[model samples]
Target: MESWLEKRWARPLYLAFVFCLALGLLQAIKLYLRRQRLLRELRHFPAPPTHWFYGHQKLLQDGKMEKLEEFVEKYPCAFPCWVGPFQAFFYVYDPDYAKTFLSRTDPKSKFLYKFLMPCLGKGLVSLDGPEWFQHRHLVTPAFSFNTLKSYVDVMTQSVNIMLGKWEEICGTRDTGVEVFEHISLMTLDILLKCAFSQETNCQINSNHDTYVKAMFDSSKITFYHLYSFLHHHDIIFKFSPEGHRLQEISEVLQQYAEKVIRDRKKSLKDIKNQDNAQKKNYPDFLDILLSAQAENCDSFSDTDLQSEVNTFILAGHDTTAGGISWLLYHLALNPEHQEKCRDEIRSILGDGSSITWDQLSEMSYTTMCIKESLRLAPPIQSISRELSKPITFPDGHSLPAGITVVLSIWGLHHNPAIWEEPKVFDPLRFSLENSDQRHSYSFLPFSAGPRDCIGQHFAMVELKVAIALILLHFKVTPDPTRPLIFLPQVILKPQNGVHLYLKKLSK
Candidate 1:
């Protein structure tokens, strides 16, 4: 009887051991597949020597723009970057290399994007394979040229609202306003109205907006987790404090998006009750998604709808906010370019408060200034991809399938060989004559590929409208007291708020 009792306990313990052994073997196989697929043939390819065990972990952890610049200067095109012993990533800055890689049907980096998964949940930004293709195809028409044109009035109204608030705030005080604090909220408010046809009045309450705080908090955490070796493991990360915080913030963000989806879905059902005639006539992005879902269930589900919309809400707000904030700073720094852009806007609008769809086309100088700013401080400084097939580049270099590829849009834009005095805020470089002389892939602010930003047209239009209105009413000048420091966030943004002095202009 004693023997039987002892044997019973041993049986359960043996089962547990077996289970663990199986799991461990499975994980080992996965790691082997990942490493073997990304062959170390490219390990000997040009790169700074590693620390043997940690590889380039220390260098990457303390990584800055200087590191990126040095590498680009030395290699000029493509070079390997080892994040750790396991990670063998390749960095490509050459336009030709960029063009070639972009042309391929490579997927987004699986390892790096895991951080975004809890928040984004397989959204357009993180999606890959056939799923990504279908989602991109569905959303492409939502940002069509005609659709973007239709949004002009909504964009105008959103900008006008922001400017009106700015007028009151800047009326008596000579003290300049922080550009990011104002611009980010304005963009969020505009995104809601444009995407789901919901005016969130985000600017009014943005200071206390939990969603905004959560998003920015999550973004910083993501950057931190990017370099942390332990955070890469899902099992360990989930038990950590950062992971707990990510979960809490993700719930807040997801709930907020759920509310947006629910409200819009209900409003569409009772379309006749919508009091605003203008808003009633046009179908917003949500409406299009809903229509598609009803027609074909397989194409888009409720989960997919929420993910895509939330992706846009997060992406559409912050990236544009960062881009515009930097754009304003650049314009403020270069008063000459600011005046030229203002002159172009005035010639087109001519004291008219409304920025018509047709007038936007005439503001060529303004567009140039915007493009130059994007080049100087591209919101998304770099993008990473993973190859599905082995490929050879035009430069006689080849990399195996499944390796991580970092496309340094920031590096390419700032490359001295590709650009003349790249640091200078010279909008003239983007002039039709000059721009044509430059390589196609040299200036990839929107990225260049089948997977390029879907809302590129929308973002450009929104930027033009905002800049036109802001410049028309106030001349932006850099705050003499506060200097800005750029940091590589989820998007490239100034470390602190962007401070700019705005002198209201008389018509």
Candidate 2:
């Protein structure tokens, strides 16, 4: 009996030792192969290096936009180069190349955007082919003209809440106030009211607290994933602190979203039982989303519903909020321009309690201001596309499959070749006569073509209403102490926030 037991234990121990030895050897081989590949790649395209084996890492670490621009300009057409064993892109600034890659119909988005797959899942933005088509069809109805009009009251109420808060804080007189945080909160409230019928006050509170803090952490994690080693295909999340934080935030945010979704679903179920004809009394976007059930019901799933809710919350709140913040910041800096915008608002509404759809259409100058603000400080600063199939641009340069391309707003918007005096803030450039002479893609703040922003109409309405109300109440002036600086992160935000004084205008 003793001899048999010893024999069994001996075999198992030997196998375990062999397994350990094999793993170590495999790791060593992988390291050697990676080093060889890096050296081979470096010979063709030489990347600038840093001392101490850092190799262009400091530039990445700094995250300064100017430094990044310099890096882009160093290479031909601002293409990003790799460093050492890890393959990472630096910058891509060619417009022809951008159109070729981005316009391609493929699942090529996965290569560069692997980091977002976990957070966004297989939602419309992250999908391709039939799955993307089906999902987009189902969700598009939520943002339709009639559907959007239903939420106008919610938008008005949210804006009213913001104006009231601003009045209370600034004491109904000429007082210095930063508008970024207020705009951010106002947009958040509008999104919540329209999308989910929930509300949270984030303006008066330290803009750096709680929700904003969580978002900051998440954005950092997003930036960290730019390195190829930290990509989705690899299990690098296990070793990364940023990845861990991303996961934690995902859990926290999803829980919050799920709670709201559950409540909205319950409310819709109750409403459905009462009356099928009472469509006008529907709750909000959540109600429409829940009721979007089709006869086939094949396109919709529990996962799809969850993903849609998360997408709505993020996109609805962030993009509009960012645009509004930029508009406010610009208005604060240029009081003469602000006066022009106010005059336009007054001409259209004439002290009306709310801006009707017809009146919103008449505010052409206000629209021009918003357009120029977007052109200068577009909320989505960059968009990426990875080449899935070999394609030649209009310039005749062929991009090989499996390379990434980017349409850089930083470069494109500021290009003097496209816009004469591009640095100047001129809303009149958007006038029918002026814009008709420019290229369609030259001033695409909401982008162009099929992949452009879907919520643009909704956002425009919200901004027009909010700006009209704010202009009716106060005259914005920049605080001499705090100059505005654009801090580009996930969105273009003010570094110190938009600090300005408000003078109460006649009601």
- In order, what lDDT does every prediction score? 0.82, 0.68
Model 1 lDDT tens row, 1-507: 999999999999999999999999998899777666554567546787677557666765554777777778887587777665566778888999999999987888876788888888878999988999889888777898888888888888888888888888888455588879788878888888877787667778776878867877777777667767767788778888888989998899789878888887787667647654435646678878887777768768888998888788787888998888998999889899888988888888987577788888888889999999999889988899888998788878888776789898888988988988888999889899998998899999889778889999999999999899888888888887898777786677677789988777778
Per-prediction count of colliding residue pairs?
0, 3
At residue 400, candidate 2 shows an lDDT of 54
Off by over 4 Å in 2: 1-57, 68-76, 81-85, 199-217, 227-236, 239-241, 276-283
**What TM-scores do the predictions have?**
0.89, 0.84
User: What TM-score does candidate 2 reach?
Assistant: 0.84
**Candidate number of the best TM-score:** 1
The prediction achieving the highest lDDT against the true structure is 1
Worst 10 residues of 2 by lDDT: 82-91
